[model samples]
Target: MTITELAKQWQTVIHHKPPIEKDPTSNDLLILIPGNPGLVNFYICYLDLIQQQFPNFEILCISHAGCDPNSYELFKFYGLKDQIVSKYEIIKKFVMDNEYSTKYNLYFLSHSVGCYINQRMVKLLLDDMSLVSHVDIKYVGLICPTIKDISKSVSGVRITKLFNYTPIITVLSILSSVLTRLLSDNYLLGIIEHYHIIKKPALVDFVSQLNYTNSTLGALNIVSKSHIVKQVLTLACEEMKLINEEKDINDWFFHDLGSKVKVWVYFADSDHWVNDKTRDELIKDYYDEDNHNNIRFELGKSDDGITHSFCIDKSVEFARITTNAIRRLN
Candidate 1:
């Protein structure tokens, strides 16, 4: 798969699966967006699983602008808002240029911070009556979404504590970048195998393709930049507050896409980044009479031991749950 530049300064890895029939009834497209450290390769296993289940659907995963492993830079002028806008532009261009809105059904699968971008993109589409009227967005699946203030959450507090040591994070980022340049994919694979971190051969291959330097730099940017961290935390907190107050969160944030699109939200039972308290609160909000029909929420089994980064350790289970969720939409 080659990386294509979708927009000015934005590049994405595309995986196209042509429809079996020349004129199939449904030519659906599944777009996956990763969270902080937005490395598209990290979701390869999950992508592969979904493709296997729905062979007719084409999948596209976009990395953050300038976040590709080959072009790792320490100081890039990219932030949360910029990332979201870039994604919106990329998707809008693709759908309009290919007439995908008329030819295909659209589904968004977002993880962590990508859920924010997905919501913003949906809002953009909703605001453009001309564009939205033609587009048929069937479903949106948010996996381990960090949509509310995480600072007060279990994982947020821990991450905040870790970020308090700016020097350590910077040093680690620099070291990781340097090591990534020196180490071969095989060497990394060997280390992972030695530790038995992942047993599946296909998943191991997918992970081997990641760009560590880019991921490290992406992580560093999110941790070191006060403004970026503040923005994410604030958005999450405000969203929860509105939901708790029984305000029209859909109208306020999603531009009413919450009503138009079927939403499946998957949350890990013990996610540190999104604590149980906040997760339950959001579930209650989604279950409100107004949203009960549009939103479907699920919590991962506590015995499964899934973490915030389930893509790494629980890819198969994650894929299974996502597949089941999408099936429900059908």
Candidate 2:
């Protein structure tokens, strides 16, 4: 299937079917939750990598409510708590619809703010007496997590400042939508700042899907869906407002520690969307290389060139990194 087709398919609201009941690995369920602008489209390449690396593992990717393309039929917006609840309900249904078993182990793969949702959902599920004894949470993988004090992040600070001018942003989004219809075929702007006669940036260098043709299409999608633009901005504002506080805000910092679940974290050396100070402190306090090493943290090398949005440029490489981490679990 084409990359665009696969991404569109992933955006569906239906949960993926459980692994083949007879397969030995059927008991293992891996769910990927993407960050804000939680469209599953951005992570399609990464998902393909994981599936290729671990064909036996059944995977489900969840897009935040209102991010699905089909959901555009109706105009609705969801906030942070709504996302957490929606994800939890989806997982619950996935579990219940399949054969119930105590042998099942749940695994979570998350990116950006999805990391925040993963932590809360894990805690919430564990707290429930109904499923508490029925299922086990085995592993959690966080890529460039934004789980704590997001308001303090570089981008968070900048975006939060923009929140005060939401009316202006909203108006611009509406204008962009109107202009998008007139510009879909050729998206280049008549700008002297750019040296190239280029219509699109060199997205092919990082990711093939970022080429001139694809990027023009992407721009059209962004502009045509003004609601999505507004939703993304709204979500960012909500994130800055609510995704604050230290690690223990929900008493989740210490929950599902080394003994209960194995957690792996990979972060860029420099990320505008990350609260570096908070991430460093969490690593120092919670990471243990020796015994009780439930959480393993990897800080990127400064020269490695991976960024917060690694999926676009390094999906294969990052997928290899993650699959390797999971394989090493004892």
Candidate 3:
């Protein structure tokens, strides 16, 4: 289907392949939640790889509200709580409206800030059994999760330091928009390829098809707005600190989700956004020593030149790693 056809109200996109049969297990779905600048098209390459691995699963990618430049007005209301609540509501509505809970096993795949949002969504599902009783959530994958001390992380420090200057970010945003408009898609693809931002030649076509200007603007807005960025960083730090407490760690990890749901967390060894310190802390605090059955962690190779945004550039390697993790879950 075309990008326009996939686009839905509130800047959401749902991509699904037609089911081959009426069986619930055969019609299982994978829902993707992207990080900041949450452009659904940004994940096209990653989703394509996943579809190749599991052809039976339908995929849905939801962009954050106001991520689209055309709906920039929604930015005013895009607070932390608002984002989580809206995402939760959107997922609930989609599942209920399509009767997916009765016919499909749902899987969640989240990246960066989406991991935090997905945790909250899972907490909500656990809290209200009535909402998720019929739903079969098979697995959850969190890639490059920024779950703690984000402001202190290498990438966060670099990004926050640069974006601390409002005028600079604003100017950069405008310049980016202008450049995106001026450059031909081929030229842009060539530039990205030269920098190795997109290693897979096949993915260049999909990247070129996206609205670069809009995506850039959305990303810039997130970094430039001090209040929004501060709020998110603060929330993550607080949650991490809370989880570190001995009493809360178990509930934070398990939350009565039971044995059926499997969670896999993939961390990059050299990820500046979520560094070794944070990753180690999470493992120390939440890694279950007793059973160690449902949760697992896989670390990426630092020498592989994988960045925190591996999904965008290292699509093929990222897919292989994620596919291996999925297989381990089964």
Candidate 4:
């Protein structure tokens, strides 16, 4: 699938438009808000699969600001809220430029922290009296989300301890900047493939499953050219501060957007980022069939072997699961 990209510096939003000859009929828009380290480079295959599934819908993704190195600027930070607003503005501009005045479905396909951004984007887009309300948020597919109480999760606890206590973000940013200057892309790729550095067996499994594809290379390329470590961790620290609350999610989405939008969340069999108990509690407390009939949850089995960072090797499988969920949405 050839992706048509609108690139501005490293900040890029890629889209797959059905061949003009095919002349797509559906006016739906599906926007993919990528996980933190918010580069859309990791999701080429995922978007391709989704485009194949819904040939009519336009599939688009924007890389999070400060994460892209293609036009490297000093590593600055855009917190989680900024990311949400940025995406909303981009989507809104696209809709306005295209003059999509008639009501149409807006489906949000997001991973990890992007889920939080997705929900917020939906709220913002819906509530915006300025935009004419042509874009109705129809569905939100949250994959391995970190929407609430992340500080309580295992990974969240570790990250909170590290970020709060240590100056790791600054130190690592300087270190990564130096390393990028010293190292070659090929060298970095070798290290990534060989697990020469911090080799978490769980994460490398994504690279192991998929050979050195563009996704893997792009992941390394960003690190080599940009000090995104600071940007990533900076946003992460803010996420720890802001995303600890979930009642807000219940207040806005389950109550305000209930039935008007369908929400599907897929959970990893075991995710350090999302607590299992919290996941269960969310299902039990909020999912009253009479009230929140628009919400549905999918759980991965222990042997399913899909990780939270599903964009790497598991992109195909995750895409299949997500597209399947989209098919079921009203």
| Model 4 alpha-carbon drift over 4 Å, by segment | 1-25, 99-104, 196-212, 291-293
Q: Against the hidden reference, what TM-scores do the models get?
A: 0.76, 0.81, 0.74, 0.87
Error of 3 at 255 (Å): 6.0
Per-residue lDDT tens digits for candidate 4, residues 1-330, read: 112232443354554454222333446777888888787777876787777777767767887866666655555567777787777777776776564336556788888888888888778887798766566677888888888888888988999999878988878777777887898778888887677332333444553344327566666855675456777778888888888767877667766676667888789999999998878877776676775448888899888778987776677677778877877766
Give each model's whole-structure lDDT.
0.63, 0.68, 0.62, 0.73
Poorest stretch of ten by lDDT in candidate 4: 1-10
Q: Clashing residue pairs in candidate 2, if any?
A: 258-294
Better of 2 and 3 by lDDT: 2
Alpha-carbon RMSD to native, per candidate: 5.9, 5.5, 5.9, 4.3
Model 4 C-alpha RMSD vs. true structure (Å) is 4.3
lDDT of 4: 0.73
Model 3 earns a TM-score of: 0.74
Compared with the true structure, the alpha-carbon lDDT of candidate 1 equals: 0.63
For residue 44, give model 2's deviation from the true position in Å. 1.7
The superposed Cα distance between candidate 4 and the true structure at residue 207, in angstroms, equals 13
Top candidate, metric TM-score: 4
Per-candidate clashes come to 4, 1, 0, 0
Ordered list by lDDT, greatest first: 4, 2, 1, 3
Q: Between the candidate structures 1 and 4, which one is better when assessed by lDDT?
A: 4
Query: What's the lDDT for residue 2 in model 2?
Result: 37
